[model samples]
Target chain A: MDLPGIVHRAGGALLGTLQHVRIPGVGQASVTDDPATSARRWRAVTVLRDQAAVGTPEAPPPPLDRFGDRIEVRLTAAPADRGTELAARFRGTPSEAEIGELRAALREAKQLLEVGEVLRVDPQPHGQRKPTPQGAALEGMTEQAPKEGVL
Target chain B: MKAATWTGVNEVSVEDVPEPTILNDHDVILKIRQSVTCGSDLHLIGGYIPFMRAGDVIGHEFLGEVVEVGKEVRDRKVGDRVVVAPFAACGSCWYCKQELYSLCDNGNANPGITEGLWGQGVGGCFGYSHAMGGYAGSHAELMRVPYADVGTFVVPEGVSDTRALFASDAASTGWMGADLAGTEPGDVVAVWGAGGVGQMAARAAMLLGAEQVVVIDRVPERLTQVRTHVGAEAVDYTTTDVVAELRERTGGRGPDVCIEAVGMEAHAPGTPGIYDQVKQQLRLQTDRPTAVREAITACRKGGTVFTLGVFAAMVDKFPLGAAMNKGLTLRGAQVHAQRYIPELLRRMEADELVTEHLATHVMPLGEAPEGYRMFKEKDDGCVRAVFLP
Candidate 1:
């Protein structure tokens, strides 16, 4: 399926010098040069639409294509030069740090659109709850208890 | 800034932590006025709901004044008094559009952990563990609120901070339970546990036009509060056979609706309680379903069982046969605070929902560790603890 104009721009700006490559399970990664920017700056868009893409366009298609209705990840690099330009064009002028933050934000945005929310992790991983006998017993004592057969 | 942070299991300390800043365009920073310890916090501090990290600021029910707003924040501004819900929901998501804010698709920053645990991710909650969303909680002087326009509601005039505070979680959760249970005219509703949520659920049942609301609790003070303040009949489960008593109270049929407000960490009185305790202690089960089991068994034929408490994982002895045989419907959920906050505020403004009695212990933020201890131990009849920063 042909990528949308915005997707083309985002992919080109985010991933430098796109190429057509097939990765197992993730579907196709198609690289195309952006006409809006100079070729010397390595301005190219790489769209990695998943196999799950139905080919029917949504009103506003998801930020990242879905992988089997669950997992979604953008695995390409766009150039920093066009990244700033695109950020200013759409999200207002962002600082360099914000531009750096934008990539992560876009990745999270894709996850949210595809899987309902972004995955979170503790700043520092504290291990599981203390497994004392009373603690374990009380752990099971919930009013809105989780259903059986789930961990 | 001094805030309460979780150090370890059953161990929390008020320590100096860096103040929060506006991290996103839609974020707002609040100067907290009042932050309260919820019953659910007990689960976190006790290490029931895993995913807490060392030094994680832990609190969700709070009221504060807006001190700063991000560039894209539209409705809220500096100097607005607001009560923020525990759960953070993006207003534009599929679940939020459907009025299921707790199930908001795009709210939780960390959905992978929850998806692994519950098959699908729920929404993000403040001061809850990373499994919910590692967002810093409200127990500090300055805190950042994301999606402020949707989750933060302006506390109207004439509603006291004490009354408005419970609206954040307890009141909203209880109201949602009653709403889900479909409490209607001439219906008899039995609520298990008379903590903040229980008391509120009992009151909500009455507000929603239940013919008779009975609150069950082993604690004398909670039972008395439910009867005297909520105007519901109180049943002391310790002193009576709860199932038999419920059947007798409802003319030999169970109450039309049963609401379980006491979450995981239920206390059972006798042999069955010990049986659940042993099974859970041996790592055979993740939930001690004393209240849930009882609710299912005691619910009238074709009645509804609503679980309002927070449950993290699996449970043993579910009694699905009883549910199936009697044609009973079971429903449970985390509170969708955004949907009910405005209406609850209206009720508080009119003095129709009394919540001041629920805040039995009001202390400074410095004494939060002590407050948590008292609340956890149920020391001196502490139903809820309010912390002023």
Candidate 2:
């Protein structure tokens, strides 16, 4: 195999291992597509940890490669759980979509374990269309205006 | 399907919209039988809430019959009549478990916008702006209700649609205000405004064993309703000095609990209201806080002040000194309807909570735009405009 193909395969294998290696207190969550998945393969991991020690773990910067692969780590405190929560996402290639899926699974698993349900909202991925105050009023009166849903 | 949609500031129209379908496993489609214009809807129609889009459907207080149910919905079935809470909640969330349904962590469909606006997102509310989770509202032929088992309550067989409809928002919110204020036996409770919410709060205080309840508003008709319908004393702010009158009525001590049901758009008769109006026009402040200011000033020392009104953003000249010096306890929240709806329903069933008087004007759905105008103007003794679809 070509050198580039070898490196890509090696990266994919590393991500696959990272996806399943569950740390104590942090479990594997469900996987879902990130809104930006189409532009760049992004994956996230949610970790449940002691509230005080949540962000203690220093996140290493996204690993760089010739294939334009990257990873980002984030931590947020759960409001009611009184615990530390960690989420990580990676962007890479040669099975990047698979890695993204795995990351989503991990995030969902963490939410389920901590909150007991997957948070859901309508995915307005296209973002909001800025409405002019006057234009919005006119559009609202029109019968052909597009309808938006609360997910 | 025809739905009352927000066209712009002070603009609403009943327009043809697409029919809602069951989108999730726990979802249900409801054919709306009755919907009401809530005071909070004024904030949306007035452009006080920035997250509203041009074509967003508006009207959250509703009673409907379930026409379809998703596979995951276990408790509700088609043909069952139900009243939906204004806000959507995911029952398994930590907040929901604690009975804080309005603060459900996972309910907002448009969390990104809300998180940006409030530094954190709240649960989704029907027909509210996108910040509250842009779910289509109930002033329509049909609406898709997600997590149906958690958010909907089956109407009792004997409760009329008019009486049952207030349970959806106004009654529940007012009951919650009294509940938060810790209304007790022999305590004097004062409620500001005589709108649907204000009337409900006054009635709720009476139900909670308050010795006396007083409702304040400018409209003579509403005050009359307060006196006759809700069995509470009424005060006309325009004709009398509110703080002075409150002090005199409470034996010079002031009310034990003061509830502010008049929200951001509060108007003071004199200079303060004019000042707030000028500031609001210049984008200096978003809320007038006229009633809240008076509520704080009129509350007894060490008394509890319950804010049941909806204030979207910051207001100028809040009397923090009175709150601090008087040792007053101030609490406010969106109605966690799920926590209080069942109990309120029980009260309704027992004929203790009468809500039919609040729905003074009932009209067809097609005249919703006119309804909004009349309700906004408070014309012809219109407390609430009920829309029969």
Each model's lDDT comes to: 0.74, 0.75
Q: What DockQ do you compute for every candidate structure?
A: 0.05, 0.07
Number of the top-ranking candidate, with DockQ as the measure: 2
Q: Please give, for residues B1-389, the per-residue lDDT of candidate 1 as tens digits.
A: 88888878899888888778776677898999999988889888987776666677889999999999988789999999999988888786556776889887566655435544454557889989766767788888888888889899999988999999999998999999999899998899999999999999999999999999999998888988997899999999889999999898889899999999988888999898898778877867666789999999999999999999887776777899999999999999999999999999999999999999999999999999999999998899999989999
Q: Tell me the tens digit of each residue's lDDT in model 2 across B1-389.
A: 78888876788877777677666777888999999999999999998886576677888999999999988889999999999899998776567877989987657644434433344457789888866767788888888888899999999998989999999999999999998899999999999999999999999999899999999999878999999999999988889999999899889999999999999999888899899999998988888899999999999999999998998867889999999999999999898998888988888999999999888899999999998888989999889999998
Candidate 2: regions farther than 4 A off: A1-151
Clashes in predicted model 2: 12
If you assessed candidate 1 against the hidden native complex, which CAPRI class would it receive?
Answer: incorrect
Best by TM-score: 2
lDDT of 2 at B57: 81
